[model samples]
Target chain A: MEESKQEIRLPRLGEPAPDFEAPTTHGTIRLDDYKGSWLVLFSHPADFTPVCTTEFMAFAEIYEELQKRGVELLGISVDSITSHIAWVRNVEEKAGVKIPFPIIADLNKEVAGRFGMVHPGQSKTETVRCVFVIDPNQIVRAMIYYPLTTGRNMAEVLRLIDALQTIDQHGVATPANWKPGDMVIVPPPNTQEMAKERLKQRYECVDWYFCKKKL
Target chain B: MGCISPDGTPTESGKKMLLALQKGLRSPQDIAKETGLPLFRVRSGLRDIAVAGLAEQKDDSYELSPKGTELVASLL
Candidate 1:
């Protein structure tokens, strides 16, 4: 039976995010619609669950902040469109935070399976918590997954988006636990001569293999 | 670190431990016995699982967290 359905493959870093058209709570939307803007494509196990509810509320809180940076958010689950609408309404009424983004109704599991959101061992019917950060060019920049019991950290997600955008604009990588205004890591030197020269440069170097410079 | 690659993939022993967890084995000794891996290797793999948030340590045993179960399913 599983063989009858199309196989789903998760997109890797530096690869183009898979494009698809699906019915969402806001309306029908496509991956192409998000072109020229960064996107956060995330999936939860199911709608109305406690963990998912908290995550949605958190995502809603950051929606405007993300928009300010030219980023959009798209959420997905195996639930029906009606369920999504009801959940959004319920959440808004209870939490008073509007969900500005569209929630894709991936009833067929086409999108979920394609994104490897559905883990048979976990539930066989529900998606695990998954997040994909795609850049404006549609290239996937990062992927994060969490267990059902753990709600995602919204601050970390925003920080990652900022880090990715910074790297994109400056062509430099961020150091561990990087935040805005933090010194970013310089790309490692490719040749021994360059490595030797790098040490003499002004950047702070823990070693030739590691160096950080102010952006 | 030894059980997981830099890219976040589980090494061979890591995969074995995950498989054992999927089969409902929770104790480190049980996982080692089920996968025929050494006790130290099983423990190392369990640590990787915990680090990845795929499993949780409860008392003296380890159990597959939702993320770990999902990973094992995806592997299958």
Candidate 2:
């Protein structure tokens, strides 16, 4: 029974993210170095790809906003440092956006393998689109995996960080398709009487079955 | 070899990719016959973990990614 448990487990989510040391074009970075901050650990399929170029540029365009939220961005790929350097430079030159953060050269794919970024049948050596949001403690707060055929939603990523922060501050969950400034979902009452009272309480509801309380 | 231990062994770089060749297994019967997984659990775990990108379709069959294979192999 114990032997069966030796299998590879999912990355611990909503907990501290795993730490690693990897060489980049500038230098090596240990994942733990960014404590007390949020990390957007995202991956792309490969260097010199068109869709990935647009995504990176979009991230670069919003770099300051993410930084203002006390979050750091860590991009990774199986490409070598030289390839990463060339790709970033190529994107900067062609797209006119300076990629401001460090990109991990996961040539050995240690980080990718750990994170389940490499979907072999999809593209063996290439990473599919995956974004992991990790809080200061390193626990992954959110994970979004996209197929090799699709690009990720950048706006949603930022919005999620905002939503997560809002929830942490107010102890309320966001409603479906929630955006900033939208009403939050209040927790239900602890007792049956309270639950009955809650149904009577004035809140937005298609019915009590799908009710939402604003904080 | 494509056969991995229950330890989530990393594929030895050039190991035969048995999974990459699988097409959609369609049902628990196929998954059970092909993967040796229990019919009931394979169907449900497929639905549950599919949201997390576990089982994926290739042409018409089901296969596991290196990472997903590592994940399930470990669960064994």
Candidate 3:
């Protein structure tokens, strides 16, 4: 069993996300059901905890924003469905914020194991904080992991989604710390002839290989 | 499916959405605004409502079918 656990494959970026069907606070949901939209599949350490509660509230705050961007949020942890329901209700009552998204009650840890959320060194029985940004095509676009002590930055999450969608829609890469409406990095030229033309074009080019453009 | 029971009864949010439709809200956005449910939930609920034959869509708007009208009448 230990050997098999060691061999558990962590999902990689640009690969199909491992499929899952799990019961949630809302109902049973399948990964395939979210194929036509972007999904932010995230796992927290445990429910009713301080950091996770704040995080849930933060997520609720951005739920509509994510919806506007055609993204869905699904949270998970190695907690029972009843526990999830109680905790979400508690959060709603105390924080006066509604959790609009579904949260997977991964009591069996099957989904956690598939996503590599269970880090033995972090907590053998609980999942670590992990985030997987999957595109509309169901491909894993990005992955982020946070240690148990630190809470995640929700703004960065929105920014990355913006970056991914911008990249897809405009066919350009975002520069470091890119945000919406910011200048985008153009694909660099490979051939010398193309390189010469790149500088002559209507872009902000430091050189033939480095160019940025406003979209 | 999220807001519908296996036997096709509308759950809380589903009932709210159907109620919004009974109030003559047609678009998902309008239903969401009227019911205060998340727009995503409203949209997903619309799909399930149509699947259950309770609502029908025309263009971007939705209204109750005869079955839906009867159900809402009973829900009251």
Q: For residues B1-76, could you state the per-residue lDDT of candidate 1 as single tens digits?
A: 5476669888777888888888664887789679875453466567667888978998758988998888899899
Candidate 3, lDDT over the whole model: 0.88
Lowest-sum lDDT 10-residue window in model 1 chain A: A1-10
lDDT of 2 by residue, A145-168 (tens): 898778788789889999888888
Lowest lDDT 10-residue stretch of candidate 2 chain A? A1-10
Task: Give the 10-residue window scoring lowest on summed lDDT in candidate 3 chain A.
Answer: A1-10
Off by over 4 Å in 2: A1-9, A197-211, B1-76
Q: Which candidate number maximizes TM-score?
A: 3
Candidate 1, position A156, lDDT = 97
Assess the local accuracy of residue A187 in candidate 2 as a C-alpha lDDT between 0 and 100. 68
Best by lDDT: 3
Off by over 4 Å in 1: A1-8, B1-76
Clashing pairs in 3: none
Question: DockQ for each of the predicted structures, in order?
Answer: 0.01, 0.01, 0.24
